[model samples]
Target: MPPDLDPRLTPARPDLADICLRGQVAAERFVEGRPARIAVPSAPLRRRPDVAAGLDTEAVMGDAVTVYDVRDGFAFAQIVRDAYVGYLPEAALGPADPAPTHRVAALRTFVYPAPDLKRPPIAHLSLGAAFAAQAREGEYWQLASGGSVFAGHAVPLGHTEPDAAALAERLVGTPYLWGGRTTLGLDCSGLVQLCLESAGLVCPRDADQQERALGTALPPGLDGLCRGDLVFWKGHVGMMLDAERLIHANGHHMAVAVEPLAVAVARIAEKSFGAVTSIRRLAMTAELAETGAFTPSAAS
Candidate 1:
């Protein structure tokens, strides 16, 4: 089997088989229910149908999810973006909207009660959260939810950032949180996903899934590492800032930090993470690099 195809890359959620990834139950059971859309700025995707369960990931506002079952005020569903199966509170979902106009481009922004900035904020939105625009005020975009966000902090649906690596640099000091994907806190895969998604590249929600879904594998070794290269170890990943340094949201530091590649390798191994498992690079042309238009090749 190809190295990237290792079964460990895909999470095994056997306990959720009837309602999750495997979908062992009959389709008719879920197909009859209407598809739901995320209504809040962000909702926790949990391992079980309870608030106390571990968070598996987060679904942003306007993201679609197919509801399969509901129990104890929770909805068991699969996120449309990455097909991740989890349970979310029923309150987090509402009638679906097939079209969304813009996505949050800033690390974090407030949703104002009115178009005026002086008005108190009604809610907060994180980067990559989709917003449906109803109208444009002088300096804000009025949302269908009756909240207004700064116009400059959002971009049209299809807009892509020029450099993902450069974008990741902005989160250098963010606190690390397991299963988080926001500026307030984030994990290794969350860092990569946020950075690459901002560049209009599709990315999965976990380090292993990301390893299997993005970029071409490079020959093993540290000799040819470059900016934007993805370096992977068991259950963890980091991006190369250049040939010799890497940045990652790590437990060791409990924050996103940059460290010498050699030092990081030794430290991780000392903690029994094992050696580097793979190195992958996104292919880009000199012109694309200059223009900041990165097109990541799907994993092979």
Candidate 2:
């Protein structure tokens, strides 16, 4: 019942009776062990920042995280039947499907976020949210989890998709935090991820997380990036709204603001005292959200 509730995660299940799943079910298909959704009375369950794997199964001393509000990584219903709760690196409460999904994918984000710590945003997903995905690189159907790429185990977003641009615009003025992804505040990649997830596009939680979502990386020069394209500087990420302009929720700007792409680059270059890392486009689909996806070559 409940897709893959293996009675392990659901220790209360009548079927398990004497079976001790330790308040969780076994990992079957997309199911995973996660904290039960209930209201808590005290401090939240904040895992170690370096927490690698065995998250759901680790020791829980105090009250478990009830009333889910994770904003960093995906959470599951069980450590191993409820697969990935959101499949993206962010969660609030209630369902994640918003703005009316236009596409959906069954991709559980744990496939990517779990393995790529640099791309943690993919971990913030909720139970039963809208999923939107399409065929990408002929194999994995790209899901929009925050703003990155993640490899997963045989899952696909369901068909009812939502408008990505509309979703992206909704979170336009959200603030930027080094590692935040919520309406209260968010970083560049966080904004991108939440915006896309709102549209049912499951994505990862990092700038590099954006690479596969776009299918291919743009050549490293500024000339290769176009309007709506994204650029990455080591840990930093921004969106190229036009040839000369980009928008992002940057700590430098202290909020979600727009500036010339070159100016931002100059600032970061000046700050880091080194060469910019790389430049990339927003997910290929977003271009359709603007110029109908027929953008001219940036080389022009």
Candidate 3:
């Protein structure tokens, strides 16, 4: 059998082997290709079917997923965004729809029952949750989800924030939760992924994966650090706010925090993560260039 087809699609996650490889190794036939979409603001993708199981990632509202099996109240599925397979509550899914028209750009926003902000909210959406806009009412956009959101909070599809590091700063003090992607809680990689995704860059879910996939390596010293530069240590990552400071969601403070890069490096090395592995500078997207967020010196 091909190495990639040995029923372990994600070698890091052994728990999924049974579900992903059932047809090949057991008599149980695997179901294929049932389209679905996330119906909630954010849905937890767990390592197991139980609610208490360790979270693997999150599927935000309107994310496309392919269901391969349904058991109890959970669905075994693969997220279309990153091809990450996991289990999420079956109740959080609904029929797939066309691509969303806008995405929530604020840290959090409410979906009011009507166009009036005074009315009660029907749903609360987090940053990066995509929604289809059906119409405009006053200062609100009517969502296909049957609610209206403030127009200022939703940006047209393909609109991206130019300053990813500045966007991440807004999330300061957010509680750190493993596998969390919302403002309610976020892990290190989740923080990076959310900020970058809002800037229209695709990012992977885990620290190791992000380390492997993002940016070009810089010299092995703090001298090269700059705003938006990525610093990686074994199993952890942080984004530099400037040459002196970095912002990260970490278990040390148990929240997103900023500290002097040198201080953080010493503390993290002494206590947990052993040493810095690499320093990387990301390329500027066209959107960033227009906003002058990236300079020639910053890229180096």
Candidate 4:
């Protein structure tokens, strides 16, 4: 594989590659990938097939993935939502039919064996997880795969949250996880990605990709910072809560935390990540606000 091709996004290897890449790269063979959907509530996508390998990200229920190759118990696949390629446990996948019609909107929710909430839950789903709803029974939605989830916890696929910053702030105190994007645990980029998705914006998976592709870059300075502004370091990213505060999932706190931008900048600079590389502001939707700005008081 050429060094220029990012392995994180490319479904190619020296031995095999996706048929879609036939003309773009050299490989021993190319094959049309098989389509699959994530069956479990959440499955880790790792850099390597081994469980010990670093997790690159996660695929949630009903997410479409293309399986380019399978070995042992792992499938080398690419998630359609973000085009992220990694090794996922083969057991985590299922048939791609009965496509999703709703997505989990709550931070976390339970899948019950029956419509009754009193029943023991079978599985837990996190925000952004997709599911196919076959019918409504009382206050629960019957899933195509056989289960019921609280109807209020999910919304139609087209639904979107009004404020990205406020939505992210709801996850304050989420545990810092290297490659997780669930309420169970999450990383800096994962937090930003989830929040952006809630606001109906497409975002790339990693911080470096997010910095390079998301929003319009603002000239160097903290004076113009506002809610929804993305503050990026070399390998990390965070959202500004306002002109003075920033919220991020950080190893230093091992959780999502909010602090003055000046304090975070000085601490991060003195400790490890060096300094802020850029501050980019997202184009606000009309729903975000008429003035395209957010205040903590209003959210409260």
Candidate 5:
């Protein structure tokens, strides 16, 4: 077994492993996982089966997953989007079919039971949630899963945002929730992951992993920084709104907020987060791969 494999992203466990890793890992049983999709609005992927267990991340509507095991109402699965492995509620999953054709582009939107706006909402889909549109009414897109969503809030597959910084700007003031990934809440890395993924770039879920896998590192000292540059601290990450301003989902404000980069640097240092470890510039040169897998030393 390769010690470099990150447990957070690897599907191998002592008792079970994804069949793809049969030769690479030691497991009592290896199985070809069953395909599934997140049916609920958003489901927490927790580190353990218990409700009180720590949340690793979240899987939103239409996200694909491969279920390896089901026990105690929780399914041990690997999210196909990022290869993140965790346990999510079995009830939140539905058959993976009627492939998604559109992605929610709005920060948040409501899905109505009928095409009429007057109808009560059946569910709320956040940015990056996927849904297949089977038909279009006057102003609504009838979903393949039996609901209607405002057509303007979603875009056809392959449509990409112009830039991630602008997208991050629109999310300012959203509450900061550790392990969250939706507009409802999100942490530093989660915010980065959301914005980058929306812009058609692949991003890792944790700060350290992102620091390693993301764009080219700039020369030290934060000189010549521009919009969309990523700043990293040991356990934290933030994006440059521009040369002077920094935007981040931080605990200091408990919300996504902006401030001068120098001020943030000073305060963060005073609080013992250490200095900026690296500054990365996402050139957007690489396209998003069909499958995102990770190989990093276990950390975070």
Candidate 6:
């Protein structure tokens, strides 16, 4: 190892394992893809950090609620479900979901359902884990565990609505895994879809589908974007804010983070080598909006 480099960091990188939306573009052209940032429940590509690897370590087991925070050199997330909250990295799991609901009487848990592809019989979810909810009530929730929704616990602490603002803020630092969606990890459109769905909205899970759901087109510029507006390019998507910024769970930078809209636009432009695409409003059709369904794109 070179003395100039950090000692705790290793040289191995990560890779992708899956994609929720079929025929999605690669991470190399995030902005050009569509929603500038989405969710990826699959393990992402990246190198290992030796020193930060063991620093302030906390175990995120099954049925845990974690909140992604910072993403400087490495990804950082804290468990917010129950008592399991702290910092962890992005390279831990294969294809994690966003707030995946799982119930475990102990450290050992099982495959969530749709997530139970091979029917792992009793696949184990560690303590301090994460899951995406498909069903919910007072104390229990149905999640898209491996691929289906089984019963589980640990949803948002208080209320659960499909508010884009709240959902956008939730996945703040989630690592940008290639196919991950859990607090365990996330990607660009995956972030948008996950948080929106959790809020009670029913938008499409992919960027193009999202473009269809949004209805209105972004034109050629973003002069009138407000918070919760869906921003899309070619193969990527993200949330735009009145603060002249956008937030998305991206794979290029490899995590959820805020970026200047100009910088983001520039990055996408450079990558695609083309003009900016479209930006869509989150507001639903007149009928839909009148019904007060403009909370979140993923709200069901």
Best by TM-score: 4
Clashes of each: 1, 64, 0, 0, 0, 90
Lowest lDDT 10-residue stretch of candidate 2: 37-46
Residue 162 CA displacement from its true place in model 4, Å: 0.8
How much lDDT does candidate 6 score?
Answer: 0.48
Per-residue error at 115 for model 5, in Å? Answer: 0.5
Question: What are the RMSD figures for all models against the true structure?
Answer: 5.2, 15.7, 3.8, 1.9, 6.6, 15.0
**Clash total of candidate 3:** 0
Residue lDDT tens for model 4, 1-300: 677878899998878999888888889999989999999999999988999999889989989999999989999999998999999999999999999999999999999999998999999999999999999999999999999999999999999998788888999999999998988999999999999987899999999999989988888988856678899999999998877888999999999999989999999999979999998878883224356445432322
lDDT of 5 at 291: 21
**Ranking of all predicted structures according to TM-score, beginning with the best and ending with the worst:** 4, 5, 3, 1, 2, 6
lDDT of 4: 0.90
Segments of candidate 4 deviating more than 4 angstroms: 285-300
What are the per-residue Cα lDDT tens digits for candidate 2 across 197-299?
5455555655554654543467768874565566776766776655666777788767777777778888888885245666655555445536644353441
Query: Which sections of candidate 6 miss by over 4 Å?
Result: 1-162, 272-274, 284-300
Report the error of model 3 at residue 262, Å: 0.6
Arrange candidates by lDDT, descending: 4, 5, 3, 1, 6, 2
TM-score to true structure, per model: 0.86, 0.47, 0.88, 0.96, 0.93, 0.46
Model 3 — TM-score against the truth?
0.88
Report the C-alpha displacement of residue 171, candidate 5, in angstroms. 0.4
Where in model 3 is the C-alpha error above 4 Å? 1-30, 285-300
Worst 10 residues of 5 by lDDT: 291-300
Measured with C-alpha atoms, the lDDT of residue 201 in candidate 4 is 92
Task: For residues 148-228, write the lDDT of model 6, one tens digit per residue.
Answer: 323443434333454565656766777776544456566676677666655546555456567766647755676755567
Stretches of candidate 1 off by over 4 Å are 1-33, 285-300
List the global CA lDDT of all models: 0.80, 0.43, 0.83, 0.90, 0.88, 0.48
